[model samples]
Target: MLSTAFALFCFLLAADCLETHVHGDLFVPDAILRISAQNISIGGIQRYTTLVNGSVPGPELRVSEGKVVWIRVYNDMTDRNTTMHWHGLAQAASPFSDGTPLASQWPIPPQHFFDYELQIPNDTAGTYFYHSHVGFQSVSASGSLIVEDRSNPPYKYDDERTITLQELFNLTDVDVEQRITADPLLWFGENNGFLVNGKTISDYGVIDNSTATLAVIEVDPGKTYRLRFIAATALSYTSFAFESHDGLEVIEADGHYTKPLSTDLMQMGSGQRFSVLLKTKSCDELEQSGRLDYYLQVETRERSAVATNYALLRYRDTCNLPESSVHHLPTDSYPSKKPIDLPPTISGFLDYQLQPLVPNNFPTTSQVTRRIVLNVQQFEDGYYVWRDSNVSWSDASIDSRRYTTPATPYLVSLYTNQTAYLPKYDAAIANGGVDPTTQTFPAKLGEVLEIVLQNIGSISKTNVTPGLLETHPWHAHGGHYYDLGGGPGAWSSEAMEARLQGTLPVLRDTTMLFRYNEATQPDVKSGWRAWRLRVQNPGVWMIHCHWLQHMIQGMQTVWVFGDAGDILKVPRREVEGFLTFGGDVYGNGTHVPERVHFSEGG
Candidate 1:
């Protein structure tokens, strides 16, 4: 009897050990990140802001396409709540991990933890990024998320580099938010300087200083390098180019591979990414001719307030030279000068025709099932508040009527079949105090929805000389859309049809809604941008302006697909786990109030 009992115990222990080993091999995270607030210096001034790990712009996370990635984010922030959004990622059935605060999930409060298990779908692999989505925290807590295609890429490149372009301000995120609340006309905070991979060139001299270390990309003479450019700014629209380098072939935009279109300059809005191929000349030949270095220049376009920033692209052996031996181009020769002075038009060279690398059977415009017009305008009570389709997007606010006892998120309401705050399209026009029913736009599953984002200037103040015309970079979650061509001002069906011209549109996740110019022509109307989205993802998706300030002041909305039946298709355990595990524990049921608040009238 004793010998039989011992055998049974050994069998049970072996089974348990085997199970543990198998689970560990399958479920271990590819990368673990810690989100915290840290003081970092920029442009010679030190300021405190949220950061991932210990770096501003965080760390680059790379995962193979179609692989399951387990990411554990530990929030070490003491005061602020935080959530990291996987920008441009189609979370598909995993809506709970979408990371929009009060939409998909709650903020991972101080000393809390959240584990995100993301499966990068084989079909949807491209350049994306992760950043804080809670309030103004994303101003610093951002990083690149690259999904590399496991199969051989169609484009030819010998090497690759990631370039992150961001705008920095002297004020803290809280202070910036306060200023914007006081005066909505501030838009995004005043841009102190621009940065390339978290560093800037010295302001005073041609010498490279320790304080201002330019991000360097080393290259061999005879090899082609793939440059992945991410415009991760909170506000600014940038024009990017490499000085004295003309053959920049843009092969990918927003993760979709496109036909190679060579251009001297590329324009990127906030949350957009582009991959360009740069072929280097023979280093021996260039050295023989005395040209050894070049600058990758990025500058704010369509606005005069931001400064230009540059990174060095040094030849492999050129670092032996003195640090002061830097090459500076003439101010007039910069790419920013051309785009700023030229009329706003899509260049076949820059905005080339993009088609999917593996062409799937997608419906054309004629097959679209629904059409929605999103009119972008400013609503003024005392301060400027942006509205879409006359509905200012509502969230759980202290002063708003939508605030609930448990602080229900907009997405949680949809998942739980709670319709108390679901906004109706028509009622949102006049209803004021945080009515969710007015702000929500509903759709059906697998429906092809066409959204025409029309920007007709603001009512409060003119941001630029050409009226209330301001650029808005619109981003959609949970899906990629086909970017149909846009035009100036209100688009009629006929105009849209003409713009399509019976061709397939480029697939992208973020698109810039350009501002209209009266000076271009007297008959020009306010600017408009159009995109066709297939509502394949069932979860409530947040669509908003990537301009962080605009999104804060109600320039956002949600697209609800199907009904409770469709929402229930998601794993019940995932929904419950998110509601129970995610959220601010310190505030209990109530939300922590912002440092600044607008007056009731404002």
Candidate 2:
């Protein structure tokens, strides 16, 4: 009897993975939606084509447990090349069709097509999305890719809806480049306007003439609904909430199931997704009135921005809640501003320094490796830049590694370079400072590695964002490690360079964002800074910003897994040299490295 019951339970769990008929000829469908600014008195005044497929928010695709999913992408864009990446869904198995250009696969050229197959091993369910992994994230090219639930869920919901709030900077491909290259801070793409479905916040203000105000989704009030939200903006931090006649309840986040957290305020950032279960107990409004109201509010002010979307709860007149008003909030319905329990601050999101969100789940503290900081400087023009000669956009450009010259390393001339150098905002780190002639990435793996991101020059709060001091989420492709804090230095440079004379723990495909410094307390909401990960995965994995821009600018690098824990055969090599990392880092993916073959005498 016991064996029969166990077998029955397993059958039920496996039954949750129902297959969906996929329309091949597409890998990540570039969305084609309409975008118009809100509050435009005249209708259709400012309009443009958005990258979402057939719908403003594209379709969601789910892969089965232990199955391979094949994707064929068709790019209809006549202008820029486009590619799609299954964001947050790392490849531990084949890692094919990962969709990152050059580093992973070549991008699908304009008006062309490409096909890829992903071999998903273990079963993992979550609310994930696929976007143009090639270049600018906000300019165009992004859509959600949901991996359906193969296992029965605990929550009860009759329907499910995913809301992706995106921002649009109405500039042409070329125009955006100039603005970003000139003043990355002012570039609207960084953290500008938004689109729900494919419209803007002030949809009500300009519902008739504006294209941005059309994401009103209709729903029935008597039925339970699930709202899956993804914060896909480059750098727009939000504390979002939903309001109908009553309040809202949230159930899941980052695709992982979580205990319900009922609050009027919740925060989400780029690369993060959440699921909210909206119950219909008080859904009587649909019957009494005529229309059930759902409101999404967003504010773009001095230091913050927020946006949210909801389904218009519909009912067959017998429901119990207010019916006349669809989803209505008082004219001034936004809650009185209150302190939120969000991550302590932006630093909490930057895990390159003191990774806060990363799980410190590694073996024993066998190794303590330290990385040296090369550059962390912010400019008056609102852009920030990091410099180091020891890294490559894709580990070593070649599939193979070469040994010689100790990678010809060098520390930047901070004092001299600070005053003389102008800030760079493009991705083109093609430099000869380190002799690519001999050096390679993941030098002798299996050794305890400590990568330090030193901040030199000066940081000005007046020009940069508040989270500048905070370390960013540093994700190691093939390993996991603990988080060490971020500061001026550990104990003097010489003493600190003692190297990891110990063994390091093992980590696999984990990520961590750094915490902000509490010294200059500004906002104590998002907590994070720097972190370390144990490299265990033995493959070529690339790490970059979930946001498209920062990543386009050489923000990505390769993590190579050498022989596991073989320090003797793969001993570290110490050498003498001065090399600079520069160029193509800020270019479009395919274009970045090419720039190295052309300019600065690379």
Candidate 3:
């Protein structure tokens, strides 16, 4: 159901609009994404949902490395505002295009289009993705963004394939959102099924002959293929395992090449990506075994009923067909490889072992200019809500009408020299601390920051057993950082630096903070994760949990890099119409603002 009529024409336009630059050439209007509400079916379950180009998971976009491209996104939905977030791409110079609503820029209202200028750094060449950053639309509105290597890559492969993993929600996004945010919190942790490239067999405790198509990745025998995976799930920690294949060499993680490491099992949380080289079996061996297809089993690792999904990895010569197509359910006998029983701790296996291919000159503890310690906790003020330390990120204290999604974006107020509308915060709070009034963290331009996120058992307003702990996948908006790893009880900087032994850490834009409780680790009561980065990108960036339910409950805050003047340094043409109410700053009158700016800034 995806529309592809404008592919060839878009490429031609990109070629003709190139302008030479220092890093590479810049292409204007490289591609156009049209978002609309469509009636689509996934795994035989139909739902009226929002989609990009009328597809559940949007199309894969492949571009050469070290290139800048302008992508135009149009929202055609009748009643929803949206924004696009490039998951791993570092918007170094164009910070406003980071695509976080209210923090980076205003959300693109319905029936309007916005142009996003994406600059892929020369060093960033691997797997990544783009998704909606507002509300729960990311569940259905997302796609893979691949930056292919212009020259010869480090690893050789005969072919390549992309697999996007997700969780299926049978209800409408609005209904689901209301349930999660309802006073009674009727939305318990229950999902319909798991997805592999938007296809799966419906095994929700029923025996129905639904011939749903499974994603088929055909490969020639005795050839190696690079399998790129993006975890676009809203609330699932997925684990993948090959039925009869082993020795998958992981070469890339989060758009950065890693030292080659072989593993039989691969695990990923939301907003994460990786690349693995899979070598197919020989033709003679496959013929002898009387099997030309294998199953790639995917399982959800959350604390619930483990939903299983399957995808077919077929050989090229299967059934003597020209090309092997999708494998439907109930046709062939299922593979013997079922989902493995793995502990939650095993999910962090690759985080510590996979080192960066390019060594980094790590900074010593003495060089760190600031350190931030944040505690993750859950409370029940009226309904259940998650928070960082003591406060959650809602603007109800300032403006009750616009609680989470502000009527006036903080960036717009800063640009127009209107500070009264924005949240009040003390930037001189020594070491750049969090301001509960504004729910923002302020940092200088060139300071090196070390952030520690500590997770503790849930605290509530009632007397009951503490809620079970869950793995929280934290993601950053502006750029990537060095992952220094996680711990059991509490975070200790001295201990972490000593353990490094003057070695560099793996670079990533998103990582997981493990949870601890009486059941998991009796000796330890809390868990923690540490990361380090240089505060170079000048703009308002958001740091939040990738899980949609938690994010909606206010488990997020914004980081203001540099001052208002620094962010205003961005070219006026890039953010002209976006900072105002009409969305006509780009000299075109297409966009419409959904809400009025009640503050004086507008």
Candidate 4:
């Protein structure tokens, strides 16, 4: 559904704009990411997952706060299209670069490239990550993005370690996608095991002992180390704890500083990040106890069954010990004895306790302009499909050929005054939720919104009983929101009123909607989480569950911020001729000759 005016405008300008790369301010690529398919061994199995630069978890990207980082991504995969999403950073300045397929921009064609200009604002420095937002590719196409505060950092530590956590599967992306979309939908089973820094020794037994090496964290005797934990899981809620360690204190979450809170274990779903300080024990104390190494245990939470993995935390002096000695540390094997008791797990209370170090700037209830409530439900005629309220959103198009290639994205439509596909505020006001056709909730320039997300059981066409309720890690695309609070049962205005009284809200891009045990809480819907935010970013942004299977089954919605006049004011060089179907109409400036385009869409 390309608007006539926009199509004509492109045709008219196509003749004269061949040589011009772009006018106005332009930022070149600071880093180049060549995405391709690679074979990597995880837990003794070779997973056919897409990788960035031939690595499973990609590379660690470090940038400074209050600066712009331009990264050019080339889709080297021969068959599929891809896009990368900056998980924790608020991409307000560069809305088109937010990287949601068919929402912010189109998927980069095979052998084509797209440039992402990310503007990191001041006072936002902590653990963050970037991942492929298309389909289930993010299971392996993710890496750590750390923003350091050079001017003034809040905490002090001797050194830092980046731990990218994920669940490794034995199946390929195509196999899982085909099974999910088949006539009788098949669920992708639980991960084989968890990974710490793209490596782990199986706790069950040695699998491919030659290739299975546990991640080792070598530290001096008595020094504090900042451990940045990034959960890049496609599914499962993962928790991490160090054996016999008592000096762990969390100092950051998402991309903001948090008040120091001590805890025995930290639990995080996919797309969540946290930084904690771990003070290592003295060598004398460890020698007296007859142990120079400890197990960094990782286990799954809120699953049908439990799966555990381990890594080694070795003292620096232990590396010099003789191979035959008792204190020698082996990085490829597990300890002889496992801990009898695991630590208690944390849930929604993690958000409640860790207050933001930055001052609270959230608007009061009286200043709020709009409020929306959405219930996450499942529908199954034969296959499972998730919906918000009554609308089920899909990324596919009508024609079979254009299944992965939809029409122009909403951002392009809004920028070019293509009103046919845009969402209307009046229509959204008339309807309780978003219009099913548009699949968007419209917001004005500076409106404050209070959104409540409730978790409900499944409903079917044949009047089947409500299905099981599970945990959903919901993540916002454009910006972070203030997490008000969450509770069991349905959402109530009374609970909202009580939680807003003299409370300082914590800011998080991703928050969990917990699931209650069906046996304990029978005949009851499980949990709900609330958030408050002001719509300042202008563009199309998606909010959905971070779990890839739920998202693939249609558990997502979009928000259209500002009107045409506001959206059209964005710079012309930023939007036009980037990765649209016209194939860089501005000529050779956007498309580098290093790679030849073989296909248009996935």
For each candidate in turn, the TM-score is 0.82, 0.60, 0.86, 0.88
Best by lDDT: 4
User: Worst 10-residue stretch by lDDT in candidate 1?
Assistant: 593-602
lDDT of candidate 3? 0.72
| Per-residue lDDT of model 1, residues 113-158, tens digit only | 6666576877555788999887678878899999998888888789
Where is model 3 poorest over a 10-residue stretch in terms of lDDT?
Answer: 593-602
- How many clashes would you count in candidate 2? 105
Off by over 4 Å in 2: 1-55, 137-139, 154-156, 183-192, 201-210, 217-224, 244-255, 258-263, 281-291, 299-384, 387-534, 563-602
Q: lDDT (0-100) at residue 140 of candidate 2?
A: 44
Give the top-scoring candidate (TM-score).
4
**TM-score-sorted candidate list, best first:** 4, 3, 1, 2
Instruction: Candidate 3: list runs displaced more than 4 Å.
Output: 1-28, 204-211, 318-347, 394-405, 418-432, 516-525, 570-575, 586-602
What are the Cα lDDT values of the candidates?
0.67, 0.42, 0.72, 0.74
Worst-scoring 10-residue span by lDDT in model 4 = 593-602
Candidate 4 global CA lDDT score? 0.74
Where does candidate 3 clash, by residue pair? 577-585
**Distance from true position, residue 557, model 3, in Å?**
1.4
What are the root-mean-square deviations of the candidates from the true structure over C-alphas?
8.8, 14.2, 8.1, 5.9
